[model samples]
Target: MCGGDFMSKNPEEAMDFLSYVADVSRGWDEPTKGEVGKMKSQLNAYNAKAGM
Candidate 1:
């Protein structure tokens, strides 16, 4: 695992965006949380596609 993996092209900006996403996602509960987690997991595929 590397910081670069989660770090976007713009380090400062990406951390900020990730923090915002975390804050919003944390508010979710149960069924909604699971659904959102699934979507977020799908987005994880982007890392593979980017060859990270």
Candidate 2:
């Protein structure tokens, strides 16, 4: 439940680039609005790979 856990990289996981973006135009909620949620999801998906 820490940022470090979310930012950890897995050796077995495929590396992926996460592009940071903001969606604040009202109905952009993919569980939560704004870039915060999206970023978190992306990070989790990518195992928090850097150079994002």
Candidate 3:
């Protein structure tokens, strides 16, 4: 499993990472879809914090 700590690097990096995650999460089950949504929310918060 990959550690989410990598997301703290920078807004651009986080956006790219989340975009990849969104792509990979496509067609996933309901629970996994929920997780992806949570991840997207986190990424949004991070971007906001970074003024992206």
Off by over 4 Å in 3: 29-52
Q: What's the CA error at residue 7 for candidate 3, in Å?
A: 4.6
C-alpha lDDT of candidate 1 relative to the true structure: 0.72
Candidate 2 weakest ten by summed lDDT: 14-23
- What TM-score would each prediction reach against the true structure? 0.39, 0.27, 0.42
Q: TM-score rank, highest first? A: 3, 1, 2
**lDDT per residue (tens digit) for residues 1-52 in model 1:** 2256664447887777788878877876545777889888878888778887
Score residue 46 of candidate 2 by CA lDDT: 85
CA deviation > 4 Å runs, candidate 1: 1-9, 30-52
Q: Which candidate is the best by TM-score?
A: 3
Candidate 2 residue runs with Cα over 4 Å from true position: 1-33, 48-52
Number of clashes found in candidate 2: 0
Q: Rate residue 33 of model 2 by lDDT.
A: 62
Summed backbone clashes in each candidate are 0, 0, 0
- lDDT of all predictions, in order shown? 0.72, 0.50, 0.80
Write down the RMSD of candidate 2 (Cα, Å).
Answer: 19.9
lDDT of each residue in 1-52, candidate 3, tens digit only: 2385875668887788888888878856455777989999999999999999
Candidate 2 residue lDDT tens string, 1-52: 2235535756333133122223243445544465778888888878756544
